[model samples]
Target: MSCSGFQPISLEKPTPEDEELSDKLMEKVRSVGGFDSEETKESKGAVLLKLDQIAKEFTELLSSAMSSTEQVSGECHIKILTSGLHGLGVPTNKPDIDVLFVGSRLVSRLRFFSLFYIMLRRKEGVKDTNAAPDAFVPVIRATVDNVEVDIVFAGFPSKDIIPGTLELRDDNILKGLDMESVRSLNWCRVNAEILHLVPEVDNFRNTLRAILVWAKRRGIYSSCLGFLGRMSYAILVAKICQLYPHALPSDLIKAFFELFSKWKWSWQCPVLLKPSTENWEFGDLAWDPRDNPKDRAHVMPIVYPIHPHINSTFNVTESSLQIMKKEFNEGFKVVSEVHNNEACWSKIFEEFKFFDEFQHFMVVTASAADDGRFRRWVGMVQSKIRNLVNFLEPRNCISSIRVNTEHFSPVSETNKYVRRWFVGLVSQRPLRAKDLRSPIDKFKSMTVLQARRVGFYTEDMKLEAAYVDRHQVEDMRKENSHFGAPTLSNTAAVGTGEQPSTSSVAEKTCQYDETTLPIPPKVRKTE
Candidate 1:
């Protein structure tokens, strides 16, 4: 049951020149705070070792629990499926660990999830165990020894017993499985698919590491924030490798920016692999633009290389698409500059200049009673902020809405749990009457609606909206030195790419209910 068809190609040790390039890339990534230093790597390894121990302890305990329950009959297998193991993980400041508990008959997800939650609760130093059963991707997230761990369960039929050494690459493994099971498997499957699709593994990994840093520094990395997520980023990089199979890592890196910079996403989606009709055996829809009308709706589709073959970048909005296009062009220009003797890698991964770009901004703050509540509440609100931007963009009143994409904690010790997010607003014209008030009211209502959806809206849990000018934002940043520049202008399009307004931009505007106005989703979902 080990990796059946996909075996990683072994390579000789990196030569001196390769080492030099690797060091340079690592330095560049480290400069941007993403490089995994030796000490950090050892610490992460220790965390994984501890996680493995916990996984083994939990599996044994679960087995005992199942044995006592008359419904449990067969053995359960525990497997660790980490993005890091598949070489897809970038050396980010925070590393995520995923564990899958594959069970056989009588072990329902609810039962398994409940038992694991109980087990983790009883275990020493396992804190903040939240088993979200009704979530879109139901998972049990907890902190074990201060390392974040996400746990999910996959149960096979009564006759089916998953081996400990099982690899999910087999299509038969997925047959008759539910969407959640498919999702659990995809944690590892997508990485495998990306790695296999690329021509050279090292070339892909190093190139991806560089791109990851660039994306983070430039503030367009959040998939939930309507930008490319890890999966989409991986596939796009793999596609570059597919295009230039024999290119070195450095060349591939440059070509990646160059190719995607000029990519006509409006005309054709970026798909690394074609949709296989045979893949539908598992009842998941294969991504076929011709067959699935929904697929055509993706503004900048980066189709998943596996079944349930949907666009991973479907969360990208028209505005985010425009921002990404600008980034690609900027990235290419930076890389090209480095190609000349004029620049270094740091120039490509430079921190974004966000705060100085706009005159007005809408600052949204989510205050929670505790650290745990703050994390959950702020995350729910942040994910939906793009929806607010999407609502404003097409109305033609607001020129552009840019999300800061970073969260800041309030400076006051009394408000330690308060987290704030800022959205840069570009007014299409001078504010006339309540024109500004309408969009603000709409945004405030949307945030409340989102908080309610997460069941996080409560009396003590407060959501505040305040409009601040550039001077006010600067003062706030000075009060909280840790906060980044409070500007959305970092995402502003470069050059004369039609800056969202005509010369009559100074005209006064009105704010109304606009009941007749159409508002699109933060990102359009394929039907």
Candidate 2:
């Protein structure tokens, strides 16, 4: 049993009557600006022009600025990878530009420091360096003509500087590179072929959106940053093209799932954590898991359903997985109910009349399913809907909604099973202080009321118990001098006739056999 069940139904290419229905459906898309919407075309054009202007301005600025700086020993080169090169067809509202700074001579330590200083000085007007450096970089973001451009300066002296220098240079270096040639590479061509293979546009957009959201939440949205975020998206897209040759967006997503499911390691974007363990920073890097002898170069998993530190960093009780399951189940119900009722489907179609080939497919599927007109139509509709659901099913789909670890790694067929288990754990049992680990080792954090809340302890009873425990501890310390041994000072003990050693009291109060506590039962596996 696949995530979406497989059902066989005969689907012959539409006859004349079916063609007529398709024509009518296509007309609806045209009315709504399906493939040839003027607004979409105009928007795309505007994005291209804006990117072009930015690239030109940047090149001009570098030419003038670098010429003046004698401290800069090499010729400055500007590389631009814009929407025009991505061939996304849609107009980009925020086009990403990759900038590289290449030098003729080896950059001295002093020169590198000077370069860093210049950037710091440039950002001084926008960001306060008094803040942590990691926190400051995100605030360093600036806009030129309403276009957000992220600039990274990589100084290269010679082509063969590092052992894997050529590969890295080829992957990242964009000096004197032809934009047209780069866009026309074997990979790009492969991507285009895959795009053509997609039968529906909606499925393509849905899959792309899912991947984007996943990347964004994980803090890996750009290829320039590392392999996990934007680079991962690109790699998946490229892989789709390579495997299917003419795969559609739905096909791509299905393929991605198939590939991802087979992966032994969890898929996570790696972030460079500070020594303080309070924050994370981005770098030009990739996963080098040398310890894994079989596939040493494979990327490490960074995306988890529930971040282990979910209680602390996110300040939410529910894990990312739990939220995703709830939302996905809800969405599934909505889709199913809408499909079951002809009037509801009609209402949806009336509002979103202007649909492309993709939209037509959805309507047809729904209509066919509801009408009980054709068996194949119903199966196709269900299959497509399941695919859509799977693409949008993950916790990352809903912005800022966290889920439990169980949601991502579900042990049951139904999400309800996981939800019930989570609720039972929080309600029936008290989560011990020791059980909650600090998201960061440096922080001596405890999962008190706040932590439990973030962990999705919605029940008022659970919250009340935590509060009660806290109040009891405070009251006990105040009332009983012997029981609440003051380790800090002898002031409290002085007032009492007898003084017990702080260590002795601590030993009596805190002593608990770890082996006696009952461990929570693991979730039953779904066959």
Model 2, position 102, has a per-residue lDDT of: 27
Off by over 4 Å in 2: 1-76, 83-140, 155-230, 237-241, 251-428, 432-527
Off by over 4 Å in 1: 1-23, 68-72, 84-95, 158-161, 275-295, 431-433, 450-456, 481-527
**TM-score against native, each model:** 0.81, 0.35
The lDDT per prediction is 0.61, 0.27
lDDT (Cα, tens digit) per residue for candidate 2, span 1-527: 12211121222333464334334433433343234345534544454465444434443444455455434444433332321123433222233222222222333222322333233334322231110111111111223333333222333444323232223213233333332122112222323433544344444543454444333332223221111323234334443334443443333444554543343332232211111121112111112233234223223332111101111111112232243334334333433443344223122223211111010010110121111122212212221221222222242322221111110112322221111001011212443433222211111112123223223222221110111233333342243222111111111111110111111111111111223322111200100
Query: Which stretch of 10 consecutive residues in model 2 shows the poorest summed lDDT?
Result: 356-365
lDDT of 1 by residue, 57-91 (tens): 65565566555644645665555556422236554
CA RMSD (A), model 2: 23.2
